[model samples]
Target: MRLTHTGPAPARRDDWQTLKNLWPYIWAYRGRVLLAFACLVIAKIANVLTPVYLKDLVDGLGVPVAVLAVPVAALVGYGLARLTTGIFGELRDALFARVTQGAIQQVASQLFQHLLALSLRFHMGRRTGGLSRDIERGTKGIGFLLNFTVFNVLPTLLEIAMVTGILLWRYDWVFAGLTLGTIVAYVLFTLLVTERRMVYRRTMNTLDSQANGKAVDALLNYETVKYFGNESYESQRYDHDMRSWVDSAVRNQVSLNLLNMGQGLIITVGMTALLWQSARGVTQGVMTVGDVVLVSAYLTQLYAPLNFLGFVYREIKHALADMERMFDLMANHQEIADRPDALALQAKTASLSFEAVDFSYQADRQILHRVSFTVPAGGSLAVVGASGAGKSTLSRLLFRFYDPTGGAVRVNGRDIRDYTQDSLRAHIGIVPQDTVLFNDTIGYNIAYGRPAATQEEIQAAARAAHIHDFVTSLPQGYDTPVGERGLKLSGGEKQRVAIARALLKSPPIMVFDEATSALDTRTERAIQEQLDRIAQGRTTLIIAHRLSTIVQADHILVLDAGRVVEQGTHADLLALGNRYARMWQLQQSGEDK
Candidate 1:
């Protein structure tokens, strides 16, 4: 499928604002950061001291040429200092990495948790591949900013200050002033150019996500693609996305190259001016050959970090952009969570009731009217309706997946919303029409709701679902992995596993939405038999397309366009000869054939 791109490109101001939200996670690693800074300071001092040692060797030992050993000894000391600095520099980088990793993981974990906690409505509106890409991209900002800002940019800026101080002390103010002015110009220019170029980079990033998302979609629907023999169509679609990604990438690269070349020219000119001034000082007898050497050495030492600072600044900007997206996700105000004082559901009666409930997926269109229904204690209620008649919407409200826009859904005469979501859902079991299975062992899938359930309990549930013998007959028995979305198993086998899972929950309120729809006649009979046994002493809400499945229900609700058009027992509804009766007759006619 050709995916449509939505939304505007990430704005720079938005990105900067996003980074500000990450202060909490960054501040948490301050202790380790301080130690890294201490090491960095030591490294910078060692580097600056090398220039001083060189000056001493030249001015003191050069005039007394016979004292060559003094210069040699000073050279050894300088080399040793450089070695020590390098060691601490490495240590600082390593420690900074540790801090960045921790921060990234911590923020990532929070984002993951928050997204998962968001209402199901939010999930339905978003693409899974796009969300996953955003989450992955968001973590990168933490690592990029922490590593580049602390280890590279900060140290480079510090070195500039140190070099400036030494230049002022050793010679005239001309060189120091020149150095400071040039550094400021370089920084401002780099920031300006990078900010402009990031427009292209951001475009590239967006296209990359699209490409990834397209690949994900194509792979996910591979079975359908193969069945339709549309390999060429799929390939062309992927190629189209990749072409866009490549075009964006090329534009980004060209801009980056131009920026780098311009930066290089600026650095070359600044170095030339600084050295020329040093040479003039030497010619005036206020400086010596060694003074020029000292200037050159210090320039080399400082310029390496200075050059890297440009790259680091660009990275920081990009990182902040990523940070902003992540922070936005974290700051998302999900539907307010249950109040702190929310209590567990105290279910005195096994009844489900909707009191004039209203709901809609979007405000413009109402999916459910002011619907009302009640399932008597220990009674089975069947919701029978055409597609889009709000049968599924009713089930979702009963489960509190989305709260009603008005009115309330209650269990045992208490509003479900008043109970903590966890506590309320704990007593509710569901076998969704679209059953999904994790890629895990059969036994694990069966016991998913009750992780602590014993082998006996798992086996018993499987037995009731009439799949125990088949499961044991497999090579790995209960330990066999179900493969992705249970693709390795047949439709009937997967449905049986879902039934076994819900049965293990053993909830007082069971929702069976076309539970046996995916199964063959034999498997349906077996599963229906188990469900019938479980429905005893429990309030059951069954949404059924198959007439046979709800024939024995205590009450049948026939919905038409989000309203209850008819309600009665199966025999009574048939006598009325309305929607339910018509549906039953249709199914009976098909069965007769």
Candidate 2:
């Protein structure tokens, strides 16, 4: 199958705004953040003083051997300064780790819940692999972003300021001026080159997600691929996606190398100019030999982090890019939301009604029109229809999956729209025609209906659906694994499991949409007896293709194309010799053979 494109492109975001959005989660642990910053500042202070101490130590030793006397105090001061810098740096990281990890946990949790809250329309167009990849990259980026941008940025800037002040105060204007100019040029180069490089990063991300989505889609439909013998076709498509990704990633890396080289060139020119000027001063007797050593020491200390600074800036941009996608997911509007004044549904008797209902998935393709029906409290109604007769649409409307465009659906007595969706759904249980289960044990799938249910209760529901014997015959009994989406089980077995799950729920309102379609005639009859018994004293709605299954319904309605064509009991419809009668005759003729 031709896979659909990944969901909508990530929305554009400003770096400052993205950081602002991320701030609240990190700031939740404000005390830890403050302590981390204190450590960061102390480390920078010690780091800057190291070069100062080294210059003094060198100057003190530049004398006759007897007079120099080892300069033991200067040596000890220098070593202590270096040690302080390292100790505080480690302390800073230790204090800040909790903040970084906590923020990541919060943002990831909120995004996951937001994705779930989005409407069915949004999910229908989403690619699972691509979405998961976005979430993965985004969460991992949080740590790098917090550690690099927050920790390094402040201390690096502070060091630059301190070095600039010292150069201007203790030396000629040329020294400080040259250092500032070189840094300016370096920063401008990094920003411009990085902006250009962002295109490659974004393209690589898109291609990677696409490649992943295609592979996952192919694997999920592994049986379909084998049946059509299209393994090579699938492989070729995946390779095409990967080829694009590889090219984009290569471009990104090459650009990064070029950026680094440019940065290195600028730093080299600045440091050489200052060193040459200092040496010239020493030779001319304008500055002492010890002064030359001092200048060299200071320049060495400053230039190291400047090179790393460019790299940090580049990584920050990449991290922001990753984060923007996850925030974009969080930005998606929840299409289906309950009104603030909506009340919980009070489903006492579970009477259900559709009053002159009309609906369509899209405006141009109407699925139902002006159709109306009702099932009284403790009564059962069965709907019969040809394909595309909008029978399943009825159940969806009752569940409020998509609210009817015209008229209303009432549960008990109030309009369903006036009740919270959760409360409304809690009172209704359905055994869907296509049931998809969790990748878990058989007993676990049944218990999902009511999570707090006892093991004995689960077994009782399993037996009622006539699947307990089969489950027990397995080596693991109820613990038998269902695999992904219950793929290991036969279609009838999956259907029975669904039935047991719904039975376990024991909701006041029940909906069976083509519930027995997967079973043979004999098995269908056996399961039907249990269904009929369980549906007693409860409102039930059945949508069926087989005529024999609904013979016991209190009322049966024949639907053709979106309208009701006949309404009566089985005997009443047969006597009329109309649409329902014709449908009954056709199904009976086929079954006899």
Candidate 3:
């Protein structure tokens, strides 16, 4: 496996385009969105009118002692306006909750389904922990974007417009100009500083994903780590990744402090100048005490939303970055898509053939060369070869995991590629050399072969593979939990479970690829008897490394270096004194010793 230091490339996307892509999900709840918008408008109107009520109350206070009753009315109106503002804001949030949740659900479901539909080759190259983290962060980002953009950003802009209009109409253009200038300066500073900080944030995100990936990968290979006594080494590797994350996090925090200090400085200077102007007007008799109070109240209200605007802008950028990763994952194309005209496989006699097949995982190195073979209907063929002789490659080719580089693999005289991959695979059953079970109950794993299998059928299959009695003896019987990859079970037991699963499938064509390699001699003999019974009247292909195992096979092919060195019945090949005879003699000699 190739280990690379860098993470997946950052996605390049226009923020508006990404938002446009998300519009469909949001548009589905247009009615709720409209209701939420109406609530927001009502809330902003109440908020804007509250300051007017406060100005009236201050003017009432300046009246004689007999006019205190008028001040009482103004104070009551001010309190009611504030209460209305809060009520409408909460109502808006309630109205939009469904839209936010529905959009998140829809996007997450589509992304998950698309990921599953991707080809196995894509999965082989993916880091599971990192991919899962991206999905999680992306979904959360969607919620933030939907909530803040509609509720916070839009409302803040609306309030700013109302305040600026009020200031311009009631006073001179100087007050409105200063307000606009301060806001523009604050926003520019936030945008420029946030752009600089994004590099640190992205680096932090990448390191976090890498750390999680390393932890999960190590845990998944817990047995290997223990066997190799590499626990300390794994810990050190994880710590090394965490150290990088810490460094990035420190830089991100430092930049955030700089942004906050700059924002505070701008707000402080703007508030001081506006208050100074209002005081001068009052002293020069150009404005009443009430006008001064109104201006001060407006400035206070404006600053609240201004500070919140800065927060909204920063969060919006972060949400876009998170969403970019999710879109990248969705953008990956399917490598092995079925043709539009592909048809379901039609199996009559279940005969299979490899017609002058050649294959290679990479172009630089070849594995199979001009190899041809046939398994007639209701007949068996056994292939014997040493390691790296391409025995396993035959199984992968027959299963259509990868197409042959040249020539074709056929079922029932038709090229396998002509059939839909799902339909073709449904007719073939395989018991692979390594059996990895799901982390579920034993019965669940067996039932996976035929999801609708009855209890009697599942038990019958287990009995055929000679594992039913052992399962029954356990306290939980079939319900016993199989730990990760079935590590709780011994090698021979896992193989029996795999055999039971294949037997339950009962497909027309079966491939036993080193199916009994994990069993002891006695268990292997017993299981071979069951395999022989099942192979009757079914087309079967066996790939094995043990020479003694195929002595009773109807026909045997001996392979060496991707070439067919000998072929015939086992006894006939022994009589020829070729590669098969030499392998049989050496195995028998080793067994005797």
lDDT of each: 0.84, 0.87, 0.87
Query: What is candidate 2's local distance difference test score?
Result: 0.87
User: Candidate 3: misplaced stretches above 4 Å?
Assistant: 1-21, 60-84, 284-290, 346-349, 551-555, 591-593
Better of 1 and 2 by lDDT: 2
- Of candidate 3, the 10-residue stretch with the lowest lDDT total is 1-10
lDDT per residue (tens digit) for residues 1-593 in model 3: 22335564354468887798789999999999999999999899889888888888888988999979887988898898899899989999998999999999999999998897687668888998888888898899999898889888999888888888988998889999988899899999999999888877777778788888888889989989999998988887778778878888899899989899999999999999999998999899888788888888888888887898888888988898788788778889976666788889866459989999998887998999988999998889999888899888898889887889999999898888888989888988888899999999999888888989999999999999999999999999999998998998999999999999999998888899999999999999999999988888888999998866777777887778887888999889999997788788888888521
TM-score of each: 0.94, 0.94, 0.89
Model 1 lDDT tens row, 309-350: 888888888777655656767777787378778888866346
Error of 1 at 148 (Å): 0.8
**The 10-residue segment with the lowest total lDDT in model 2:** 3-12
TM for candidate 3 is: 0.89
